[model samples]
Target: MAKQTPMMQQYLEIKAQYEDAFLFFRLGDFYELFFEDAKKAAHELEITLTSRGGTHDRIPMCGVPYHSVDQYIQQLIEKGYKIAICEQVEDPKEAKGVVKREVVKLITPGTVMEANLLNDKENNYLATVADFEDGSFGFGRTDLSTGESAVTLIEGDLNDVIYELASISAKEVVVSEAFASKYEDTLEQQLNLTVSVEEERELPESMEGLCSELEQSKLIETMAPLFHYLIKTQKRSLDHLQKVTYYSRNEYLKIDYHSKRNLELTETIREKKKQGSLYSILDKTETSMGARLLKKWLEQPLVDRKKITERHSVVQSLLDNFFIREELKDKLKEVYDLERLAGKVAYGNVNARELVMLRRSLHQAPSIRIM
Candidate 1:
């Protein structure tokens, strides 16, 4: 073995922190990957697999231009890989040694909020489950794209936990390092989820007020870790996230993964297309918000007859008033996807075009209100 270069040594130090992710070290206009990451990325991305340094001292390396990195990231994400974006923290012209670098962001499938990388029709959720001291278990789930968060406390067997997870269809699952092994096989083989094991911490005393408000003191054990993880990874205030909506399985009609597929409620059983699904038949929705809300209602039908009747009555009125119904639909067609737009704004990723779209979307509110 030969001595490593100063730049390589610095890269190694940062790489150790995110061993599971591909580190994209920013170098001028490109983000470079070295050693094993370079090899893997080159093979997967089918980019030029080259080397750095002189002959015997050479190391495998690959990179994409900074402007085009998103396309490369999308490819890696589709292939189920997490990316740690390492950036130049200092100016190269001023630095005496190798310019300082640090991981600015970590991109995972569930956490990606870019419109191009996400499906507008579906939610991408990251979930967490932890067993409490009592027989009960606490579950936490969130969709970063929609700024939605929910928590539930369930007391049952491991199968019961699995059942709840199946219904939500979370893309990623987080658990304490010690508890990871217990459900690793079940999560991988059965649910096809990517599991991430993180260190656990005692429930924070600061969250006491929030827990009291939600009447979910028990969720402190399981749910707090998810909030902690998001804060750490995002490194920003998630102002769009609503209060944790505390719910239970009994709150909605229970539907398992197999039953959802069998019934073709949201998607067709054969090709998984929406054209022949129940959703397609009933979907006269003009806005993305309406479409998503309709899907949620279908998936979690209310068991309460009064609530069901109320919804039916509303629909009946809309159906009976032909001109008003058409007016409402016309106005709704002018509305954009406000939920996702709000999410982007909360995440501090909204641009001028999106802001214009949001403004236009809101302008339709008056006409909708008139209906």
Candidate 2:
């Protein structure tokens, strides 16, 4: 048996906290991976796998340069792998034996905010499911990039939960340990969703305001796990997160999962591509926000005749005025994704370029309103 190095000991301590994710341990100018993380990342990233001399034997090691780490991270994210970015908190010169390191960020498929990694036209949702003792389930979802949160109480079984998740194209799902043990395989293998477990069901006091509109305890319980998971993984101010919107299946036209797929409403059933879908054909939206809204409308058609007629009347008015419609489209094209930009601002990650975009987008608001 050999004693572990001080650096290795620190790495192990931090890695234990994020055992399910690839830990990118910062060393010098590189973000290194060791042992199993090293081997998997090396194979998945096609990076050179090397070895470091340990007290007993050679230890597997691989790393990517810090400057070019985003590309590697993007690749792993596309494959649905979570990454814990552990950075050296203190300078090496100031350290006693080993420099202090901590995980600054945990990038999951659902929680990604990088512009290059996200699809501008589509939302990436992180969902949470709560199994009630009465056979009903509470399903909550949030798009971290846009800070949009919503939840619904499904008076059905796990298949209904799956249908809701599939319809929304959730990238990852959070559940309790018991729920994970029972249905993790179906979620991961069948739907290809990344499953995360959270045991906390109590909603935090800071986030109580977000659920003020909800009266049902079940809905609040569902959102609590999701809110806690966000607090844990994001470790940032979620002020931009909107008030949780509660919806019912009766609010929308009832469409089963198989029926939605067969209808080719959003994507083709055969190729599962959006190019040949009804959404692709009907979509003439100028901004990313509009595109996302259009997709949501297609998935959840209005059941209320009054609401449907109101929407149709608005469309008809636009159709009647070509010049105004064209001007509105032009103004919309000049705008950026305000939803996500606001999220970044709330998360305190907004950069100078994004600020410039935000300014430009805001500048067009008056003209858009006049039209």
Candidate 3:
């Protein structure tokens, strides 16, 4: 290997830290990708593949303007690429050598919080499966967009996990190191999941005597590795994360793939799209969160007649008052997606426009109270 320039040396150092991700090395106004990253990105994005400073051995390179980089990121993520955004940490105007740059955030398809890159009506989930010695699977899933987290124990084989995950439609999955090594091919071939491996580790010793017996039992060994990976990559306190929802496999009605397809509950079997489906036809939601919650209700319909009647009573009350129902619907239209907005705020990514939207949504609360 030839000696690297000071700037290139800095790039290499940062690049070494995030080998799995495509490094978006910030240089002045452009985010540059060197060598293999450049080659792959150029090929995938169909952008100009060029080179940088070497007379005899030029390095492969590609770049996009920082202002227009989000679209490129969206494209890369759609192609199942993780991106490490290296930003200029120190101002170049006062830099002694090359302006110091660091990876600010790592963006993956499952962890994206950008409104433009995400579907408003759908939850983006990252799921994890841990194989147990007893042949059961400990499953964990979280939607970083909505801060919803759930875990369950599936008392069957990998096929059971695959079936559940397919229904959830998760963008990514993580598994224990042992599980990944053993079933990597099976998971990939069967579900076509972007599976990542995490080391198996015990929960912190300090928390051993901290909680009730129920909470302690709910703290499964599998959850630690997945949550650790998320914390490391996210590099922030996931304050928005909800309580770990431990559930039994039999809590909800089990709808198989064929049944979902035949019933056309959410998507048509032919087009595999939501248009003309039951959800689309019955979806009278005003906000993104409402749409998502409605979909969830449809997917997991309650079997308990008492709970069902409670929901029906609310609907019956509204149905009885036509004027009030009309007024409530109009008021709901004024509100925005509070759930996702709150998630973005907790993630420290909410902007001025989003704040204004939040205020507008809150303003509708008073009118809604009239119901």
Candidate 4:
């Protein structure tokens, strides 16, 4: 019937493990998809979704050259899909059976590292909860999307976590066993999260409120036996929440949609910076988050124009003024505050990069002293 390549068997196995994610099966020169994955990939990728060696009928097939897989992967992830990048760990030319294929990386909407999938101006948040007693131990949140983050130590009863989760709006979450038990009851309640109780850290039942948080956050990973899911929610009512002083309004400033109408429109940037062709830009090299940020910035430069200009000038000055790019880069590396960087970039502080472009503006060539 059909030629069942050894790789196909391995693909099936890996697919079983990651039902939520599409398997980007890596072969010699192409990354292929089979069965329904093929149909889906074909429609989404808009490329030829053909089939491989025909069987009793035909095995569905769709593929992209290994070199071009990045673009395809970026698209799938942006579509809110999880992608299990199954790569060939062994040399396909020499391997005997199915040329070993194992998932090298799993790119979910919440945890993606591709430069093409991130924004330099916004945060990609991942939240975690630890409820020891009443399902309100609060949460620890980080968003590397824009390389900036925000976290709130929740108070109140069990429902407080829900409000906090809604406020923070993180994409993924990890819960402790003690906290999961606190997840809220009321089956009719829906907040949007993947909740999984930890088996090893099992705590008493007082923290049942945390269960809602777990369910909404999708408890992406478990320390013992965790659960995971995609977070999708829009309803927000910040009730029974207290504010912490460690935060400044600068961190919470909003960029109006009308203002962000032209920061770095992906298509425009690509066209203008395409070097030879009008269809090219450095965007292909940027992560999805970064792309979104650039687009957002392009759409609303005035939101924080002053800071944005600063970062812009910094980078431009460096490229135009110095030759010590590497040494200056080391200095920029000293900056530990991504949120601060994001603020500067959002406000058009493009010159911030100048501080590290060619040399350290801070260290300088030794200031001359007057006699």
Q: Write the per-residue lDDT of candidate 1 for residues 1-371, one digit (tens) a residue.
A: 67788998899999999998899999999999999999999999999989999967689999999999999999988766789999999989999988999898888876777898987777788899888777788888988888777888888878878877777767777788767888787786788777777675555454444445466567666767877677667765577776677877786898767788999998899997889999999987887778878888998889888889999999999989999998888777778889899989988889999999899999998777766
Model 4 alpha-carbon miss at residue 295, Å: 15
Instruction: Give Cα distance to truth, residue 366, candidate 3, Å.
Output: 5.3
Model 3 local distance difference test score = 0.81
Which residue pairs collide in model 2, if any? none
Model 2 per-residue lDDT at 279: 97
User: What C-alpha lDDT values do all the predictions have?
Assistant: 0.83, 0.93, 0.81, 0.51
Off by over 4 Å in 2: 54-56
A best-first ranking of the candidates according to their lDDT comes to 2, 1, 3, 4
Cα lDDT tens digits, model 3, 25-124, are 9998999999999999999999999998858788999999999999999998876678999999987989998888888888887788889999999988
Pitting candidate 1 against candidate 4, the one with the higher TM-score is 1
Best by lDDT: 2
* Sliding window of 10 residues with minimal summed lDDT for model 4: 232-241
lDDT (Cα, tens digit) per residue for candidate 4, span 1-371: 35556666677788997776688888778888889988998999898978866455678889988998888888886665677788888886788866777786666655554445664434455565665444345455544324333334444554555644544444556565554554533211444444433344442232233233343232212211211221212011211111111222243344432222233232333353324422235343223333445443443334466886887896687577565555544444443333333433443433645336324432332331110
Q: After superposition, how far is residue 92 of candidate 3 from its true place, in Å?
A: 0.4
Tell me the tens digit of each residue's lDDT in model 2 across 1-371: 36788888898889999999999999999999999999999999999999898555888999988999999999999888999999989989988998999999999998998888999889999999999998899999999999889999998878889988988999999999999999999999878989999999999998999999999999999999899999999988889999999888888987987898889998999999998999999999998999999999999999999999999999999999999999899899889999999999999999999999999999999988877
Q: How close is candidate 1 to the true structure, as a TM-score?
A: 0.92
Which one wins by lDDT: 3 or 4? 3
Badly placed stretches (over 4 Å) of model 4 are 1-5, 129-137, 144-151, 156-169, 175-371
